[model samples]
Target: MPYKPIESYGVIGDMHSVALVGMDGSIDWCCLPHFDSPSIFAAILDDEKGGHFQIVATHEASFKQMYLPDTNVLLTRFLGAEGVGEVCDFMPIHRDKHGNRNGIHQIVRIVRAVRGSIHFRLSCRPAMDFARREHEVVLLPEGAVFDSEGQDVILLSPVPLKEDGKGGVTAEFVVEAGSCVTFALRHADDWTARNDLLSMAIDGEEARSRTVQFWRDWLSKSKYEGRWREMVNRSALVLKLLTFEPTGAIVAAPTTSLPEEIGGVRNWDYRYVWIRDAAFTLYAFLRLGFTEEATQFMEWLRARVSEHDGPSGPLQLMYGIDGRHELPEIDLSHLDGYRGSHPVRVGNLARTQLQLDIYGELIDAVYIYDRHAKRISYDFWCDLRRMVYWVIDNWEREDEGVWEVRNGRRQFVYSKVQCWVALDRALRIADSRSFPIDRPRVIAARDKIYETIMALGYDKERQTFVQVFGENALDASNLIMPLMRFIAADDPRMLGTLDETLKQLVSDSLVYRYELEKGSGLGDGLTGKEGTFSICTFWLVEALARAGRHRQARFIFEKMLTYANHLGLYSEQIGHSGEALGNFPQAFTHLGLVSAAFYLNRVVGKE
Candidate 1:
């Protein structure tokens, strides 16, 4: 079987973990129980060895899938010569009476015929521990059990499932109008359940309805009355779905080892939390009235501050789910790479890099919380004071920028701007709340960062801010300067930077992070090409909108939206042939989409 293109996959998750459902109705990638846990079905990574669970119409059938309106319930319709059937796929949102949440592990797949008649073929193969551990199957009277040395899988299905080779289960049934069937799988480490099959089906249906209701109710609170209502809503939901409910930490993307450059070595595990991703994620949530998510993430951020000491040499760029500092990067050699993308890596090495932008990201989140939440305890302000002081001390240092380039550290233009942002936001906090802090020190830090960035990071000949001090190359990160108000969008230097970026980084209406081949030096170590950075493209759209180029911005914004795969999703980058590459459905990309759409609709509305 040939590999499915990246865009052909849709996602379904139970808050704790997610599964990538292919257009052909096979679950090629799924991590059980937890987002970082071993995948039960990983054919997306190793098509031949990695096991998969597929349920599809056996005949010459065509499928069309979409989410139920205003809900996360995914419905895929299959039409063949004989009949038409619909697969209702959803994970019930487990919530308390007060409307809070917990880890969602169970996925309920129910199939029913809407018209004629369609035959469904079901294959359930639980490849434990990345398909290395094999299991022994036991067929019980009610449910089937697959038990391995350290893992277990229980089949809670309406019909009896026949055992196949290597602990697999297979079932085939025909469903006519008004006929329905259910299949549910739950994972645990040595466990059993006395589940009544009929009641489980009933519970699944109720949970599905409530999950949709929960999303619809939460979405109703959105403060955005913008023009791209559909796009914004979908982006908001995707962001919500990616969040880890137990820890309140959001992963960069759901899937790991999705190649940035196909058959290349740009793969990195993104299941861990990055302070940078979460910081911007907070703002996106706040905009959509997702106060619960925002509050949880802010608390998660505060926990990080409380645990760590001052500065810590430019805080680790990312952390484990429980906020652990040490993330030992490793490569899974056994599993063949996604489309022969060699050396499938797990855990990110960039976590150890000194990305100075994190300082600005943390300070920005603190400022955002202060602005929106309005009440900060004295203790919280004291922590803020320490953060502010640290920024003043560390603003001038050279470190890796946001891209986590492994090359030698340079005075990146975007890092300097963010250092400026750190002080700027700190000043806002001190003034608005009248908190006791060193005012002159902040002013000094702000002015120094501002002056140095302009003097060092700008190219006078090019009339724009360059990627690094004394360089002529433009970076997509420069687009954020205007958005951050480090420079006005109308400022001649800022306009020139935008123009230079368009001339250099953009291709086919998309933007690259930088000249990977050139800027990525030999001593930097890693080698590979990648797709256009989705966030950079959105940043360009935002910069254009701010520069009073609304028409051009809207055109570009709409064009980028079209790049989303079948289910209105985006990854970190778009490959050369427009495949969704990098980590699947990255948060940075979706967050950028929301911000860009909101601005485009807003500015265009004024006209």
Candidate 2:
């Protein structure tokens, strides 16, 4: 009916794609066949024109949603005054011994009555090619086939179904306390015969058990036994779900064009992988003993490092989930945005930006993963070495920083700090493993970079680092100096920077990304105002913890935890009214959560 809050949806995926099932029992958003495929249901972006598949009680009821413990299987319950109904939603996880996805996907929903009599309505709407292509509906004896040209979406069930006047299928039935109903929404393939699809609905119970076991087995490999285990485990699950298993490249988030500022023009697609986000996710996985993902992305990274050669460097800021380089931006002006946020968009244009900070994030990940999981071959080492040389040649260049601002490039201090990190970690790896490197040149360059930053980057009068080496506006990114090991946490200069960040960029215990105040015309390219940055808040917490302000760090950490949705999921930012303002279940926010939690737990326990 109306729009659901971004945080009101729970995610279930087969590691190839995910569907956002709302608390009201509607699959409001999903991309079938692949993570980047056209949506079959997109009501999250457009309420009326965008199609949806929903299973709900006909009677009014209060709803509650949760994940099955330690798994991504979601359960949504409708509790009415007279009866209660439950829907168990999951995508069957089918992976072979070698971990291949086998190129087929399905969303199997098993519904049951948990209490007295319940009346349920089930509707499966197909909006092919983002609701642009029309589909021909062929009704089966107990199911229906929606064919948008030759591509078919087969929906099968035990109950009888009929086509509504609109281009969709609908069914209504009543179930007693012990009865059950099943629905399977599948991506049609030549191999999946219609009878086999029917049998899938018949055996939904076995499939549910297998899916649950798959998640549990994957989660069993985690090595974290620290405080806040529930929230930490949920973050781990979010990371796992966001990962596109076929390529091992995790998408930043599933749904796209959900605005950073509602009704503002800040919306951009996040259903693609960014080098910085994946690198942080790798660190989170390695911290919890998930070495397989670490190993998989290393193979994925091998392809990315050699794919492109732009003017600035070899790598772009982000890539498609399947590792495609060309992501041409386009606007989908047909569908209204979520809550009428205008001009819904599909592909991201930011991928073309020259964000030099990615080198430090990616190289740092490889360095850590090599030490923990497996040894890097000389070929992989060479790729990393190429990245280091490029950074050395280009560290003095001004370009887009980690935030990917739209204004013209400036000498962002954070970008320079990461350039230093790239060289520092590369030197450490070379020395540790006897890898051949230009040791003299590397050392000279690293030292010079350090000297230059301390001189130009730091403001002597204010005793703090500036946003762009010349401007005076405080940035939460500069707090990353200690986290990146560029400066000692308690260094005199860093102490002043930390204090200034708190004073300028923080409100109500949450951290803003940067100042909108005009120091160097920072807000020139930005759209309307934005909310507090979710990841930056965690960065502040980690920075404070490292600086030995343990009490304030813990207070801020606990307060930020309260902002997560009921299912322990976080969007990219929090609005002024505390609503989720950006894409839901953001990878960057969860990675920051794990990083801060891992460091905070260890440091706090020692005290």
lDDT of 2 by residue, 1-607 (tens): 8999988888889888899999989999988877788888999989887889999998899999999999999999999986999999999986679966545588889899999999999988878877888988888875888877645788877788888878998999898998888888888744355456645544678878988999999898988888877888999999999998877998888888888888888888888999999999999999999999988988898898866477558888898988887788788899899998876888888887888889888888988988998888998888789888888888899887888888888888888888888999999999889999998988898899899889888888878898887777777888888988999999999999888888888998899988877576685387788889999999999999998998889889999999999899999999988889888779999989988998898888444
lDDT per model, in order? 0.80, 0.87
Give me the displacement of residue 5 in model 1, in angstroms: 1.5
Pairs that clash in candidate 1: none
User: Candidate 1: where are CA atoms >4 Å away?
Assistant: 96-104, 192-202, 310-314, 518-525, 605-607
How much does candidate 2 score in TM-score?
0.97
- Runs in model 2 with CA error above 4 Å? 95-102, 189-202, 605-607
Model 1, poorest ten-residue lDDT window?
192-201
**How far in Å is the alpha carbon of 586 misplaced in model 2?**
0.6
lDDT of 1 by residue, 1-607 (tens): 4578878877777668888887777888888778887778888889877777788887788888888887778887888887888788877787898867743266778888887777889888777777778888777755577677766766677777898775688888888887878777766564433233313443666777887897788778888778788888888888888888877988888888888888888788999898888888888898777888888887777777765563345357798877778777788899888899877777788877777788787787778887886466677777767877877887677777887767668778888888888888888888888988888888988998898887888888878787777666677888988877788998998888888888888998899877654443422346767789999999999999999988889888989988998778888999888888888878999999888877787789553
